[model samples]
Target: MQLANKTIVVTGAGGGIGRELCLQLVQRGANVAGVDINLATLDETGRLAGVGRDRFAGFQLDITDGEKVSSLPAEVLAHFGVVDGLINNAGIIQPFKLVNDLSMDAINRVMAVNFYGTLYLTKAFLPHLLERPEAHIANVSSMGGFLPVPGQTVYGAAKAAVKLLTEGLYAELKDTNVKVTVIFPGAIATNIMQNSGLDVPNADAGSDSQFKTLSARQAADQMLAGIEKNQFRVVIGQDARAMDKLYRLNPKYAADLIQKKMRSLLR
Candidate 1:
């Protein structure tokens, strides 16, 4: 769907891909409701959008709270008068460890933010989206969602759930006015470790790395292009595209390759 003159809601708009998306969407003539748990950073997204309050509004919200998420559509409508799209981008990663070594609390938190949060916001805004003449829903799922990453098992599992959930929505909504797209992004330059409250080695420290990480801006650009084209799935970065091919051709080899390359990061 064309973005011009549309009002779109983007979760996790405080920073990273979400922030970049907010800025780019405004440039395409779309009004944006930037939602995040961090009010300060969410406001910064509006500033970066370089638009007035009429075009960019920031809403501080914790999407994991179902009640609060359910209330967001009304609040956004009150500000923008209509909703044309929803982007489920809010998610967190787990600590680098095997599943048995991770705490139940950590596992649950990852699932809550990555999977359940997406579900809550989608259900809340789907009815409103359906009311529009045309609408779009774009969900961000990681490459780990499709491939196995040794140290991030829970994180991968959560994203995998998001992948299936988004695909199912696409199939069910095919006859409707709403369009759905799921994104598989390779490693992008972001402070996801800091956001998830974990410390990690520098991403570029691995000299033999096979993966090519994209910048946040590049990822955001790809996402917008996918949404505009109404694509069923979008794989960002050369790394993601390569892995998509590998996994489809040989799932076991793809899993082993990622495990071999990423094992050092877990150390």
Candidate 2:
């Protein structure tokens, strides 16, 4: 989708990939309505967006709030006058723990934000998007969504739902003017671990690995390219591409094989 003159709404715009996405969208000449639960972070995103007051704005919102999410289309319409694209990027990862050891509350929180939040926002915005001749929706899933990590079971489950949900949206919207894309990112260097309420030791370990994690800017760049191509799925980073290939070739073996290699990183 050509971003010029489009009004795009990006959730989780306070930090991490969400922040970078806003910056990139503005650079590409898109008007952005940045949304996040954290007002301070949203302000930072707005500053980074650097578009004039008319083209760049921030909204404080928790995507998991169905009532609030349902009410957003009108607000966005008022701000930008129309909604053309949406990036379902707001997400949270609960504490890294095995399924049996994980708390029910944690699991629920993860699902509420990662899965239901995306669903709510997408449903709320689909009608508005349909009105536009060239609209787009991009949902950010993780490599963990496709290849489960033992400790991050709940996060994996939530992102897995996002992956499938986006794919289904893509299939259903095949005949529509609205384009749908699902993004699977490898271990991008971001504050996701710290935000997950976990301590990340040697977070840089994956930075320069052969299966390198990407910077947020790189990930956002690829996402824009995917949107332009109208790709159904876009996998970012070396590790993400490798995992996608492995899982497609041998699902069972890919899981075990990845776990064996990644377990050492935790230690």
Candidate 3:
């Protein structure tokens, strides 16, 4: 699971934690195949990585497209000659609304991006990964995946699916060389709201926000640590770590607390 001299494929490489992961993976002496839907931004990630073509390659891909996702393994292998790791990092948040108020289209989009998208890439690359002497698969779930946040109910559900899927993969692959990790990240400073086609309600009220936001780079660093160490799970931020413990200790209290904290975000 050491990153050095490995070929790691990271989705969502256009921005945020995915972009940072690509940069850091190369810094750790690994070649990276960076995937994202945005060509211009994915190219920017390649530029920012500042590595040679052999060290970094940007692939513009929509993970939701099963056909395209299935072909990615061959494409990436043609460039890197091998796939050593797969990090399912691309995801989108739901519009801030209760499930009753949200449209079916909105719910489906979130699931497509967060759950099925990860599933497609995982299924596509898992066989190749199994062939490696050592390989890693890390799926990025959310803190909300394990706890209920009233407004983002469906988003949480999709992430919850990812959480279970990753856990199952870990258990099934326990006897194999392919290591699996499930990543739970707390709030971090990124453009997820805008990317999700919405805006933060209290944009100018960072000081008043209850949760502390970590930098995207910090999140990427911690996420990759799980893979390097071959850990089964990695919780990135204080907010997520605290909630994980609280939810395990008192589910009802944890659920109520998050609902109260998240009320303002709902329409």
Candidate 4:
């Protein structure tokens, strides 16, 4: 679906790829409802968006709050009048620890933010999306969702759920005007580690890293392209694409390779 003249809602509008998505969507002629836990950062995103108040509106709310999520559509409609797309972009990573060593709080937080948060936003906006002549939904999964990462087991599981959730939504909406896309991003230079409250070296953007990572803007660009083209699935970055093909060919080898390369993060 074309972005121009559309009203789109993007979670995680505070920073990183989510911020980039909000900026680009508004620049592309879409009215954006920016949702984030940080009101200051969400407003910063609006400032950086370089669009008028009419083109962008920021909402501060935790997506895991089902009651608030259920009410978001009405609030968004009050601003943009009609919703055309929903991008489930807000998420957090779990600490770099084995699941056996992690707390249930960690596990639940990961599942709630990454999986249920996406589900809530999807459920809230889906009806409005369906009402439009053409609508799109894109959920950002991870390469970890498809291939195993040693220390981030729960994070992987949550993202894997998002992957399936998006795919299922696609299948269920195939006959409707609403289009769905599931995105798997490999590694991108973002502050997700700091945001997730983990300060491990090489977990995010740092000079010493196992693989090359894409910039947040680059990742956001590809995501928007996928939404515009109504792609069923989009794998961003060479690392994710390579891993996708390798996993398809030999899951054992892929898993072993990732375990070896990612084991250092656990320590």
Candidate 5:
């Protein structure tokens, strides 16, 4: 799944890791169709990529809308002429509140964006990917998917669903031309809170020592590398890698450890 000259579609291309992925993919000689709800920011992504219209196209669309998502592949093909890969990267976090204190609307919104949005785009683009000689699909699940954070219960659940959905796709597509890769990312330095319409908190306000977070560019690099190698699972950042191992060895301990550290951050 070499990226050179390939056409890849990436959601959440307006900001954070998604924007970084678009930039790096263009550097690898891939034609990128960057999708985001924010048209202005998506254009900014294209500007940062420094690629002309021939190499990059930005589409403004809400991924949670099935009709819009289903229409994306054709639009991408019309712009790039072919599709080689799809990256489901758009997602949102829950309000920093306990599940019992959270509204059902908030919980459902998280699930819609984090889980259903990924599913819709994957389903829409999967057939096109299978048509290619060697195609790949990468979905970004969070470290919260594997380790429970007290304040982000529903967000974690949504990502965990994505994790399983990606793994299951890998199993089903094992004999097909399409390759599947699921990513688990630790905290990354990004404006996700702002993007999700939430306020930012002081980094040192909580009792837990601030964990080392990966940069958006670093996470994007790791994701592309994983897709290139046709890897089954890619965990970004040292914190995520450590938790992956810990969760495997002792899920209870891993959950408790995160709860101890993050509970103070919960409202």
Candidate 6:
């Protein structure tokens, strides 16, 4: 979709792929309402955007708050007078642990942000999106969404829901002006680990998976192109692409192999 003059709301706009997507959207002539819970990080994103104030704005929001999420479309419409796109990019991976070891609070928090947050935002914006000739909804799923990554079962489950949700939305929205695209990204060097209060793995000493990591900017670029072409699925990073292919070829074998290979990484 043409981004010029379009108003797009990007959740989790403070870090990683979200931040990169925000900058690229502005560069492509889109007016952006960047939303995140971290006010300081949001400020950094705005500063890095370097676009004039008129072209971009930032808001601090906890995406899981249904009331705030429901109110966002109206607020953005008030600011930009129209809404053309929504990017459900806000997500969290909390307290990496086995399911039995995971606390309910951590699992709930992850589900709230990654699943309900995306659902709330999408439902809130669908009506406004339907008003436009063409609109787009881009959801950030994960490589774990398709295959259970050992360390984060709850996170994988939430993202898996997002993947299905996006696909279902696409099926339902077909023959309409709105488009839905889901992204599965492999490891990108992001602050998600620190933000989740987990030790960031030593990239240099880790397995070859470390070498295959993509930059946040690279993933964001691929996402933009996928949305532009209305692709149903976009896999980012080499690891994600390979895993996706492997799963497509043999789901059970891939799952079992991953379970055996990453048994140690779960901790």
lDDT digits (tens) for residues 133-234 of candidate 4: 999999999999999998889999999999999999999999999999999999888889887877766643223545578999999999999889999999
Q: Residue 243 error for model 1, in Å? A: 0.6
Cα lDDT tens digits for candidate 5, 1-267: 999999999999999999999999999999999999999999999999997999999999998899988998888888888999999999999888898999999998899999999999999999988899999999999999988888889999999999999999999999999999999999788889988888776443333445577799999999999999999999998888988999999999998888777745763
Which residue runs of candidate 3 sit more than 4 Å off their true CA positions? 203-211
Q: Using Cα atoms with residue i matched to residue i, what is each candidate's TM-score against the true structure?
A: 0.97, 0.94, 0.97, 0.96, 0.97, 0.95
Candidate lDDT values, in order: 0.92, 0.87, 0.92, 0.92, 0.91, 0.87
How does candidate 6 fare on TM-score? 0.95
- Estimate, for each residue in 1-267, the C-alpha lDDT of model 1 and write its tens digit: 999999999999999999989999999999999999999999888878887999999999998899999999999999999999999998889987888899999999999999999999999999999999999999999999999988889999999999999999999999999999999998789878888888876653446767667899999999999999999999998888998999999999999888788766767
Count of clashes in candidate 2: 0
| Clashes per model (N, Cα, C within 3 A) | 0, 0, 0, 0, 0, 0
Q: What TM-score would candidate 1 get against the native?
A: 0.97
Judged by whole-model lDDT over C-alpha atoms, candidate 4 comes out at 0.92
lDDT of 4 at 66: 94
Off by over 4 Å in 1: 202-206
Candidates 1 and 6 compared: the better one by TM-score is 1
Model 3 lDDT tens row, 6-80: 999999999999899999999999999999999998999999999889999988999999999999999999999
Better of 1 and 3 by lDDT: 1
Q: Write the per-residue lDDT of candidate 6 for residues 1-267, one digit (tens) a residue.
A: 877788899998999888999999999889999999999999999999998767889988888999988888877888789889999998889675788898898999999999999999999999999999899999999999999767688999999999999999999999899999999998887888776667865433237443467788988888988888888889888878888999999999889877776666664
lDDT of 2 by residue, 1-267 (tens): 999889999998889888998898898889999999889989988887766768889989988899999999999898789999999988887775568888898899899999999999999999999999889999999988999776777899899999999999989999999999999988787898776677765534454467756788888889888987888899899888998998999999988976666564555
